[model samples]
Target chain A: MNDRLTAAERVAIARHPQRPNISDYISALFTDFFEQRGDRLMGEDASILGGVALYHGRPVTVIGTRKGKDLEENIHCRFGMPNPEGYRKALRLMRQAEKFRRPVITFIDTGGAYPGLEAEERGQGEAIARNLMEMSRLTVPVIALITGEGNSGGALALAVADRVLMLENAVYAILSPEGFASILWKDAGRSSDACELMKLTAADLKALDVIDEIILEPGGGAHLARAITFRQVDEAISRHLAELSKGKQLGRYQKFRRIGTAVPKKEGQ
Target chain B: MNSIFAKRRARLLAMKSLREHYVPVGSAAVCPRCGKESGHPAVAQNLFVCPLCGYHFPVGAYYRLSITLDHGSFRELYPKLAPQDPLSFPGYRKKLEAAQRKTGLNEAAVSAVGTIDGRRCVVGVLDSRFFLGSMSSAVGEKLTLTIEYAWKNRLPLIVFSASGGARMQEGILSLMQMAKTSAALGRFDQRGLLYISVLTDPTTGGVTASFASLGDVILAEPGALIGFAGPRVIQQTIGETLPEGFQRAEFQMEHGFVDAVVPRNEMRDTLSQLLRLHEKGGPS
Candidate 1:
C-alpha cells in the first residue's frame, strides 16, 4: 500500500513487519552466538540483546536493540526501547568485551530509551550517562551501525564510536517528525513538512557528517531482500572492524574525549 | 420564531467565546495554593511563598539568580548567541521568537557567572515559562559553555533546572545537545570541580537524561516532578496506574536519584552549606 516512497516513506519500509532485526543480523553475521543477560543490579532487559559471538573466526562482542514482530514479544522488549537496566546490561557486556579485548559492534535500532517513571526512578539518566563514560574509557574498538530508527540519546548511548554506519533506509532523528510538528508548528498533521525539513535520512546524516557510512539496501527494501542486506552490512562491518583492530586509538579514552569538540560546519556554508 | 431563537443563541455563543478567550482577571495577591487573597507586599515579603499553605510559586530566572546568588554578583553570558533551526523545521523560529518575547529572555535557560555566598560559581537557571523550559540548541550550548566556563575558572557550578526537557523544534539537533552538554560535563568531571544540580518544579526528557541528572550533589525543590518520563507516558506504557506521588522529589530522594529535598526558603543557605562542604582541599 505504501508504494509512493521517499526518504520519509523509507522510514516505514525500514520498520516493515518482516524486516530482519538485530537477531536476524546476529544470526546472519556471526557464528557460535552466546546470549548474555542482566545488568547484575536489576533484572534483565530484553530490549537490549548482548552476547559474545565469532565474527570471521575471531571473537567479538555483538550488541543491539531488538523488537519483536508479535505483540507479546513487543511488550516484552518494550518495542526495543530500553530501560535503565538495558543500558546497564549493555555497559556490563561492553566491559566484558573490553576485558577480553574484543571489538564492539553495536547495532542501534530503537524509538528511544524507554521514558518510563520507573526507568528514571532506577536512574535511567545515570545509566545512559555511565555507558557513555565507560564506553569512552573502554580500551577497544567500537563500531556503531544504525540499522533502523536511531532516535536521540537512547540510540546515542550505544552509538559513540570510532565509526558510525547507517543503513540506506534507516532514519536517525532527534525526535519523530510528529513530535517535531506538534512542538514547532503546534500541529501534528504537519509531520510531512517536518520530515522534509528534519534531514534525518541516511544520506542527510552523511551530508551533515553525523554518519560515517551508509550501507545500501537491496531492491525494494531490506525486508524485501534480507539475505542481500545482511551480506552488505556484514561486509561493511568486517572492513571497519579490521581497520579499527589495527591497534589505533585503542584504549586511552581518546575517541569520546574529542566528541563534539568542534562546531559542526554549517551545511554548504 | 425558531429562526429568531437560533440567531439569539448564535449571538450569545459569540459573546461567550469572546469572554472565555480572556481569563477573568483575579485579585493580584491571590495565593495560587490556598486561594487566600492578600496584598502584593505580603507575598513579596514571604519570598513568593503562599503564606497560608507554604507553597512555593515557580520563579523566573532573575528571581532564581537573586535568591541563590549574592546580590549584584551576577554577570550574564551568551546573550548574543541565539538558537537557529538547524533542521529548519516549520515555524521553529516563530515559536522561539514568541517564547523569547513572552519570557523576556533569549532562550529557555540563562547561563551566567555569579558569587554564591562570596564563592565564585557558574550559575544557570532554566525558566519554565520559556517554551516550558525545553532545551533548544542555545540552551544546550549555553549550559555546556557554563560548565566549561566553570572548569576554566576553577569555580564551583550550581545549576537550577526547570525544564519539560529537550526542545523538539530543532529535531535531532536538539537531541545532540544532550550529548554535547554531557560530554562537556564529562570533561568537567575530570577537573574535580563541584557541580550541584538543583531541580525545580519539573525536569524531564533529554534534560534529565543528560547533565541535569549528572550532578555531584543532586538536589531538588520540595515536591518537584523530577524524572525522565512523564507520569502519563509511564502509565500508558506500563498499562498500570502509577503509585501516588510517583516522580516527585520525595520519591526520587527515597529512590537514591535525589540526594536531598530542600525547601525554597532554605535553598540559599543549604547551597552555601553544600559549597562550603566541598571547599578547596576540604574532606571528600
Candidate 2:
C-alpha cells in the first residue's frame, strides 16, 4: 500500500522478476494439467504454454504466452514472444476445447510475437489473423487475462475472448511505449512520456472498452503478493466463466462489434 | 491521366505531357538503392517502381489511385474528414499540416470507391509521403467508413498500407483506432466481402497489428519492410543482428504473413485476377 508508483514504474513492477507467471498460476489453481505441445504444422515452440487442465473439477483448456523467470527459462520460452507455431498451437488447443464443449482460458503476457525472420517465415501474421477470425467463431466460452505485458498481435492472438480481464498493474498496448517513442521521436529515452501518452494502463484500457474487467493486485503490486494475486485471478476467471456459461451461446464477435466506433465531435477540427 | 507516369512527369515535363519525358527516361533519374542513373521510363510506365532493382518510390494517394483504378472511375469518399489533435501533443498539428502540404492530402490515407478492370471495389491507399502514412483518427475513420461502404455496396475492398504505424501525436487515441478498425473488419468479414490489404514499403507497428494484418487476401509489394516493431527496436531487444531481408516482402510471404508478393508493375493485373476469382457472379 505504501508503494505508490507512477504508471511507468507500475509497468516495471508488472514485469518484475518476483511476479507469478502462468506456470505458477496453473500450479496454484488447476489440477491434473496435462501439457500440450506443437502447432502440428512445423515444430513445437516453447513460448506458448498450453494444455488440458481441470479447473475446479471442470475440464478446460488453459493457454497463454510464457516468459521464463530466469535467463535460461527466458531463452527456453523465447522471452515470451511466440513464433507462428505457438499461435497455431494455441489455436489447436482452442479448437480441441470447442470439440469437447470446454470453456477456454488464456493468459496473455507477451511483448508481442517474435519479430525474427524465422518467425515471420513461419507465418506469424497469418497465425494471428487466423486467431482473430476463428476466435470470433469459437463456440465455447473464452476468457483472457492480462497478467503482465500484453503487447501487439502476439498478445492479441489469444486475447479475442468473451470476457477480457487484466491485472490492475498490467499493461496491454499495441507495442511497448519505448518502441513507439523510438519510431515517432527517434529516441527511446522519451519512453516514459510515451507511456503516459499511450494510456496503456489497465484503467485506461477499461475506459476505452478494450478490457472487460480489472483484477486488483495486493498492496505494492502483484510481486509483493503472488499467492494472493493468483487467488484473485482464479476467482475472476471462475466468476467470468460462470457468467459466460449462463449467458446465451453467442460468438465472441459481439464483444468487439461496438469497440472503436466514432466518438461524438467536440468542435475541434 | 491515361498513364501512371503522368503526375510523376508533371514537374519534369512542365505541362508538355508525359510523352516528352519518355524519350529521356533512359538517362533521366537514379535509383536510390542501386545508385544507377537512368531515365527509367519503364519505371514511370510501371507505376514509379524502379526498373532495375524494384525500388518503390514514394507515391501520393491521388497518383496511386489513378495508377490502381480505371481511368476516371474513382469517386473519392470522406475527402474532408480532417484530423484534430485530441491530446494536443506538441508539434503534432504542425507536423500534420506539413505532411498534408507535402502530399496534398487531408490525412495520411485516402478512401475512395472505384472500378478496377470493370470490377467495382472500395479502394484506398496510404500515401507514404504523408507522415509516412501514419494512422490518425481521421485516417482510421476514413478507412472505417470506406469498409462500411464496401459492406453496404457488397463490393470487394482493397487498401494499400504504407505507414509508420499509429500517429504518436494522437497517443492512445491512435491505438484505439487499431481496435476500431479491426472491429469494423470483423463485421465486414461477416458479410463475406473480400478485403485485400496491400502492404507497401515499411508497414509496421499499430497498422500491422490491426486491419492491415486482418485482410482476407493479403498482398505486399516486393522489398517492402513489413512488421509490428521496427528493425532497430527488435535488434535492440534481442541483442542480436537480424538476417538480411528479414522484414522484406519475400520474407513476409514465405512466413505466410502475406498471401502474395506483387511487384508494383503487375499489381493491377494481380488484383484483377483475385477480384474475378472472388466475384460472386458480378453483382448478381
Candidate 3:
C-alpha cells in the first residue's frame, strides 16, 4: 500500500487499453470455456460474454462485460457498454446457474449501461432492475469482480453478488468521474478533482464496506503482470466462494441490508 | 384632528391593499412548462396539475399522501431517521442539512402505512425537493423498511418515485442503496403482495434501475421523464438530436416500459382500483 496511486491515476489504469479484459481472465483462470450467446428475447450482445465453464475442474457459470481489444471489435462490443439484451443474457445465464446449482462469477468492466436511443426503447432500466432483484435472491453463490472501470448501473446490474471483489487498480462508482464532474459541477474538465471526491478506487470501496476484498495487482498495474493479477483474482474468488457456498442467500440479503448508515434495528418482539 | 387621523388610516389601508394585489406570496402557482400562472387554491383543487397545459406539478411527499390517501388513515413510520455523513464527504453534511431544511424531510423519502378507499397498504413518496429525491443510505433504509413492512403485514405497496437517482454525496454507499432496496423488494415480491410504482416527473438514474422499475405494475404521471440515463447525457454521448417526447411517460408507455400514463386527478382512483382488484376477496 506504499505510494498509492491517485484516484484519477487508478481510473486511467482501469481504462488502459493494454489492461487485461474478461477474455484474458476467462482464458487464464478457467478451462472448458463454452461460450454462450443471445438473450433468447433478442439478438446476442457481444458486450456481455457469458457461458458455462470449468473452474478448477468444477462447473461454474462465468459472465462478464467485455471490451474489444481493437477498434473493429470495440464497435462490435460498443466499448463494453451493454444494452438491455446484454443484461438479459447475463440474467438468463445467472438463472441457468441457479438452476444447475453452479456458482456464478461475473467480471465487470464498463463505462455504464449504453445511453442510446435503442437501449432506452428496450427497457434498459427494467433490464437492470430485474437483474438486481433476481441476483439478490440467487440460491447459488455469486461473486462479482471489478477488473477495470465499473461505472453506473451497468456494472451493478451484474454485481449484486454475495461477495463483490475488485482489482487493485479498478474503479467502481455510480458513474464515471468525468460524468460525475459534468453532472455535479457542470464541467467535465474537473474530472481529476471529481475522481478524488468520488471514492471509486478499490481501496476506498473496501474501506467503506462497499466491496468485500481487493485483489492485489502487480507493481505498475494488472496490464504489466497479467498472470499475477489472474492468480490473485482466482484465489480471492475461490476463498469467497468456499465460504459463501454455505447458506449464502440470507448472507447476501444481510450484507446489503445492513449497509446503510441510518437503518433502524427492529424493536422488541 | 379626527379628520386627519381618518385620512391617514385610509391611506395606510390603501397601501396595504396595493401591496397584497402585487405581491402574491405563496398563493400563486406558476406552470414552468406552459409559462402560465394560476392561484394556488385553484391548482390544489386540480390536484396540483396546471389547468391550462395539464403539466403536473412536482408534489412533495406529504402532499402526495394527503391527496391520495383516505382521510385520517395514514400513520407515518421512521419519521426521525436521518442520514449520517458516513464518508465525511466534503460539503455532504451541509447539503443534507440544506435539503432537510428546505424540504422538512429527514431523508428524501417519506415512508408510511396508509389506506386508499379504506384498503390498507404501505406507501412511500420520494420528494424531489430533498436532494432531488436522491437515494442515500437513509433514503434506501427507509424504502427497504417500508417494503419489508408491507411484506410482513400482508399489505400491498405503493411508491411514488421522483428521484434524480442515487445520492452522489454518499458515494458508493448511496449506490448500494439501489441494491438494498431492490433486495428487499425481491423478498416482498416472493410474498405475492402487489407493488405499484408511480413514477412522477423525472425518475431517472439508479432509482429507475432498481425499485422504481421493479414494480408489479409501473405507472407514470402524464409527461413524467423516466429512463435509466438522463436525456442530456444520452444526447451528449450520441451527438445527435433526440426525438421529440423521448423518455416521456407517453413515450415510455408506447415503448412498453410503463403500463399507463395516469393523470394526476385519476391516479388515486386507479391505485385504489388496482388495490381492490388485488384484494383477497372478490371486488367489493
**Considering every candidate listed, which one attains the maximal DockQ?**
3
Summarize candidate 1's per-residue lDDT along A80-130 as a digit string, tens digits.
999999999999999999899999999998988887766878988778766
Residue B228 miss distance in model 1 (angstroms): 1.3
lDDT of 3 by residue, A26-109 (tens): 999999999999999978999999999999999999999999999999999999999999999999999999999999999999
The clash numbers for all candidates, in the given order, read 1, 8, 0
Instruction: Give the whole-model CA lDDT for all candidates, comma-separated.
Output: 0.78, 0.79, 0.88
lDDT of 2 by residue, B1-284 (tens): 45555344334322222332322445666677898765656667757777777787766676667678876566677767778876667788898788667555677877777688888999978876777778777787778778888898898999999998867776656665665577678788989899999998888877886788888889998889998667876687678988998888898887668889987778999998989989786633
**Deviation from native of the Cα of residue A1 in model 1, angstroms:** 20
Candidates 2 and 3 compared: the better one by DockQ is: 3
Question: Lowest-lDDT window of 10 residues in candidate 2 chain B?
Answer: B13-22
Clash-forming residue pairs, model 3: none
The predictions' CA RMSDs to the true structure, in order, are 11.0, 5.1, 7.7
Q: What is model 3's DockQ versus the real complex?
A: 0.55
List of clashing residue pairs for candidate 2: A121-B255, A123-B255, B25-B39, B25-B40, B26-B39, B27-B39, B28-B38, B28-B39
How displaced is residue B41 in candidate 1, in Å? 2.4
How do the residues B164-271 of candidate 1 rate in per-residue lDDT, one tens digit apiece?
Answer: 887766666666677667777777888998999999888887788788888999999877888876676678677989898888899889999889999888999988
